[model samples]
Target: MLDLPSILNLSGGPVGLFIGSFLASTLLPGGSEAMLVWELQQHPDQAILLCSVATLGNTLGGLSSWLIGWWLGRRYPGRGLSNERQRLALKRVTHYGSPILLLSWLPVIGDPLCLAAGWSGVRLLPATLFIGLGKALRYGALAGAMGSLG
Candidate 1:
């Protein structure tokens, strides 16, 4: 059966990272951390490049999720937080404001949070800024940790 790792291998290189990061940010289940670490280890000098690409892709993916909510949310009310899991996933988003999007880098709640922000009427500019910054910071920390490994 196909999986995220296999797909990443197929799309290899910086492009793969972009793809992987994008997939990871969407509702789809994925994890770009391994690819980020592997790429950084393979070419430490390209840390900035890899991190930037991944962050950009992930941010765009988050934006896409937001847009989905912005447009379709009204049509399909509660779709963004349909069930108990999503309700729990969106707890922080409901409690906090758009800036809470800074935690958009998180795993389970991350994607739903982005969607909830748009569905809840969070503006696009702030959403993009917070999502991009959060994703970039996560990648930066990952790269830094990998750098210190060897």
Candidate 2:
């Protein structure tokens, strides 16, 4: 007797939230905000667990893009930025280093930032820290907003 929203909203736990968050953080076209909000609405007591799960999934997805960039860097050492977007991402990554990953939760440019950080050889530890922190903050903010609304 479960409805579509019930299923998509992950009535069991935060597992679907994790998967949706992961795909959302990647270059893939999707988002987990709705799912997060729904999960929060369903399990108000488990806000921390839901946000943490979402952040972890999102951070890993960003790292996956970083890994792809690392492989690409090794494969094509002489590759050039083919467009303005890539050039801008590289410029920001080079100028700000892994600290720029604090903005990795942003859409449109977030995925590029992760890739550029890896391509420019930003240290994994710092990148992971910043990416996770940024994602955690975002989810925290969302939970806070939900708390206020409800």
Provide the TM-score for each candidate, comma-separated: 0.84, 0.88
Residues 108-129 of candidate 2: C-alpha lDDT, one tens digit per residue: 9999889888888888999999
TM-score of candidate 1 relative to the true fold: 0.84
* Best model per TM-score: 2
lDDT scores in order: 0.83, 0.86
Looking at model 2, the pairs that clash are: none
Off by over 4 Å in 1: 1-10, 77-80, 89-91, 148-150
lDDT of 2: 0.86
Instruction: Give one digit per residue, the lDDT tens place, for model 1 in 1-150.
Output: 769667566556788989998999998989988888878878788889989989998999999888876776678875656766555645766688888899889988788888878777789999999999999989988888777323
Error of 1 at 47 (Å): 0.4
